[model samples]
Target: MFKIKKQISKLYMASILGNLSLTGAWVAILAARGYSLVEIGIAETVFHIFSLTFEIPSGVFADVFGRKQMLVVSSIMRVIGSICMICSKNLTMVCAAIACFAVSYNFSSGSGDALAYDSLKLVGEEARYERYAANQLILYRLCNGISTLCAGFALFVGYKIAYASDVLVTCIQIGVLLSLREIRLDHTGTDRKQEVLQSVWKELRVCFVESLRFLKKAKRAVFLMICNSFVGAVDIVLLFFLQAKLPQTGMPDSALGSSLFIMEMGGILGAKLILWCKNLRYRWVFAVTSVLVLCGVLIEHTGIAVLMTLGGFVAACSDDALQVRTDAILQEMFPSEQRATLISMESFTFSVIMIALSPLAGIVFSVW
Candidate 1:
């Protein structure tokens, strides 16, 4: 029980480090380094491409190998990526950095939640999964808020410093991760190598088949996943270009951090509010919040900083709400045996959507 608590703490801390990037200043910094809006979009495309390629394989590997070890590898990859992002001055370097970032993200995608859920199950606390997931989301957004709040000041000092902070945080996350124990629910009592190998193969095959079966039969789950993925794509695109868009809205570059901080705060609040919204239908929550997101994006160029910031806040809040609700639905829909793989499918779909839309987003932003 104590160990489970410790793992939960480490997961929360690592989640904070993971989400806490340079916030709104990354685009500005990249632009200052001579990257056009299109170039920035291409870099992001590179990210999703790598993610789309490795996302499911990594998840399968986690279910077969071990989640804790994969998480360690993820931290190492993120550290390398952050270093690259900090040192890079050109598009090629940024693409390399984003590639590493994508690998890191793909590796860790569904593993964390799977680990947490399995840990709770081992301790007879499986019922706490939704609450735990929600709390994790809140903590993740809280870190985003902290990162954004400091990003402008970091930029005031130097872009290198802002980017370097991500490296430092990831390093700390690695240290926390090292303390986590691997929880294998399907641990075999026998130490026979051949039998273990066969068992792993069988589990992998079952995981794949079950995932497909779920997709074919679960229409509600598919629809929810589509809505979640769409909102996620829009949120990510807006976040990537928002720093660039601020200038067009008559906002100074220096205000980027504060603007991002406001959005993060909204996300944090929305995540926290999900506790009260458990009774609400997921579709209704999605429909209402998605409309707000659409409106926010439509009016993003209204040339009012306050209005733009408010729109950003609304969009961020909606994304968080949709994410938390959709995740809960997925958790309930998938069996524990196929949890990681199914969640990874959702992530893979989102990545593919993002990859397809990235270049178009770049073109739109560049033309605008």
Candidate 2:
């Protein structure tokens, strides 16, 4: 029982360490490096392409193997991705680095939550998963906000050092992960390499087919996933472009990080406050949050730095509020056997939306 509680704590720790990336202001860094908005958009598209491809497969691997192992793979990929970014000299090289980062994201996306949820299930504390998810969002937002606060420092030091710092932090995260015990409901104790491979393939196939069957019957889950993904994609694009747009409004270099940090606080607030809406219907919640996001978009386009930053804050807040609620609902809907794969499907939806929106948004924001 103590080990189970400690597992939850470690998951929180992992979330904090994972999001404390100094290169959180990558968009601004790229703009400073003379990359055009279109070029950056292409790079983002490359990332989602890789994400779209690997998202489900990675989740399947997590279910078949172990979530802990997949998370370790995520850290390794992050280190490699950081190294690639440090050595990158051109757009193509940047895209290569982005692809590695995408793979890193794919590996860890569903595995963490699935691990935490299943761990709780073992101790019959699964009802607490919503609170845990909310706290995870809060940690993610706060750490990411702090990282955004380092934009000035990252920009000043250049990408090489900025990404090298990330490499060092990720190495530490890997150490933390090594201490986590694998939480699997089933064990295949096969020693033969060929047999193990065959077993894995069989499990992957079963997981995928079962996930599809569940989705076919669960239409509401599908709708919730799509709606949440669309809103998230829009807010993310707005935030990404704002990293460059904020500076264009004549905001001083020193204040850039602070402004971004303020914007991210909206997410933290939203995550904390969403619990208030527990009694409200999901549709009503979605309606109100979607309107808030659109209003933020309108404010962001006003060409004023203060208003634009405020707009970002509002959008982030609303987006996260909706996200927490949506995630909790979806987690309840997903079966334990296919939890990671289904969560990956949610991420897959987001990647699809991002791929469609990123380049067009870049062009629109650049011209506007």
TM-score, per-candidate, Cα-based: 0.91, 0.96
For residues 171-265, write the lDDT of model 1, one tens digit per residue. Answer: 88888888887766643211112126657777777768877897899988888888899997887687667767776666665677778778777
Put down candidate 2 lDDT per residue, 200-285, tens digits, no spaces. Answer: 67879999999999999999999999999999999999999999889999987679999999989999899888887689898998
User: For each candidate, what is the lDDT?
Assistant: 0.78, 0.89
Question: Which regions in candidate 1 have their CA more than 4 angstroms from the true location?
Answer: 21-24, 186-195, 198-206
Deviating ranges (above 4 Å) for candidate 2:
186-198
- Report the Cα lDDT for candidate 2: 0.89
Clash list (residue pairs), candidate 2: none
Model 2 weakest lDDT span, ten residues long = 186-195
